[model samples]
Target: RSYPTTTDEEDPDSNLNATCPEYFRWIHEDLRPWAYTGITLDMVERAKATANFRLVVLNGTAYLEQYQKAFQTRDVFTLWGILQLLRKYPGKLPDLDLMFDCVDWPVIKSIDYGGPNATTPPPLFRYCKDNETLDIVFPDWSFWGWPEIRVKSWVPLLNDLMEGNQRMGWDEREPHAYWKGNPEVAETRQDLLKCNVSDQQDWGARVFAQDWKKESKAGYKTSNLADQCVHRFKIYVEGSAWSVSEKYILACDSVTLLVQPRYFDFFTRSLKPLQHYWPIKPNDKCRSIKHAVDWGNTHQQE
Candidate 1:
């Protein structure tokens, strides 16, 4: 398989077209070689290889044009782009494993990805018929149909447990951030919101996040800014996570938010949900995923 840099023309064999910093933080450093550092046409061509199996990290559809600031945002064409590669190259791999955290159907439709009737793809299910294995992983948009996509969605409180552990370490009672991803975000935020630290001296002591990667292209323009923010004051995460797989990186980085019963599950071995971010309620069942507030109720339990 050929791995081309930026020089190669756009094709299925290419990868690393765009990346976010969190992409690197979650996995072990040793797997770096497995990643295609940049997007190139040759990389897509490489995907055509008839291997026993092919693991597609992202949708391989080719972009008609170049994407800028790929690190901080999402471009709809990504998933279809990868699928285009698979169809064009026809990998020797018998079965392909595709992973998605949420059911982003709009993106799928944007790529013209479904239906045996459509001109582009012959319905992902039909395309996989020839292959030995066809694996698809994502939260089932609905609880009905497609067994692989089925998931038992739950809100877990784990980060709080980890912070408690950290506290114990200081007291010579528990492990020191033994839960390396132990959180400070929830604990800190709740403290300020509840205590209403009316102290004017501590006003700027709280921040959201730094825009170090705001406009940069390289490695999502990584900076110590986020970490720097954590060091300076209490931080708040303003949005909901894009994917389930992405939580590990956010939790691993800092303990910016304060804690709660819901966020407490963040330490669960089975769930280990993301750290206390914007909203405090994890167990608060959402009326709809889309309508779900990022997070609310900064007041902590006494």
Candidate 2:
């Protein structure tokens, strides 16, 4: 399969150096464990218990050693992305062997490997990691596409969100905060759902449980990411781990009520709370969400 490549003629500014995102600095720290020792085959093997697959790139060709089938098609698309990179940049990529875990949580805790008897940390790539783990974060498979859930690739979906934002300006949206996702995956989310309006209280939050089975039967019309941009504020609460819903909510042009997350993905480190999102306390979710919506409503210009 052929992939698109940029031409200098197509964009004269292609040669200009652009500032890298702040998170790029963390690459050094992420690779620190292996900087002196270097990653060995034994280190790669150590990660197999938690890794779904082992990938090797040698001489512009790719090989995979699957330990097990990843949940849904996560491993499928992840390997597809690597193959595309090989095609996109021919001989630029180095020969390397790596372990990739498709699961939500990072398993290699840094605390486990930090003592006099500590062994060199095995390098493991995964979707998200907490500050306590040494797992290297990579972009999740949802970026390319999440066909099982009907979420399109990042670029096209982002285009749809931009169009959605234009359709309903921020001032024209509903005044309450909005969030829609499965609450069954995490108790934190179940707690968040309690913030939704009820007969006894209206927390200024409109949270909805996403019944994927029901939505699948109905062709996901109600769950369309673009259509979710009707609220002035959007809420982002972590499910099992760091969620893939983050970029979608932030792109909605609504004030994002970000519930404090324990884990983070590849790019979220660059996001600043007050500038990019309004922080919501996970423990006191109802009150925090209420305050965010109210504050955004009051500070319309900001």
TM-score against native, each model: 0.26, 0.94
Which one wins on lDDT? Answer: 2
- Model 2 scores a TM of 0.94
Clashing pairs in 2: none
lDDT of 2 by residue, 62-113 (tens): 8889998999999988887887677666666889898999999889998989
Candidate 2, which segments miss by more than 4 Å at Cα? Answer: 1-14
Task: Please write out the lDDT profile of model 1 over residues 92-194, one tens digit for every residue.
Answer: 2234343222212112122342365643311121111101212122222211212122222222223433343344222232111111111243443333333
Question: Each prediction's Cα lDDT score?
Answer: 0.27, 0.88
RMSD each, Å: 17.1, 2.4
lDDT of 1 at 32: 28
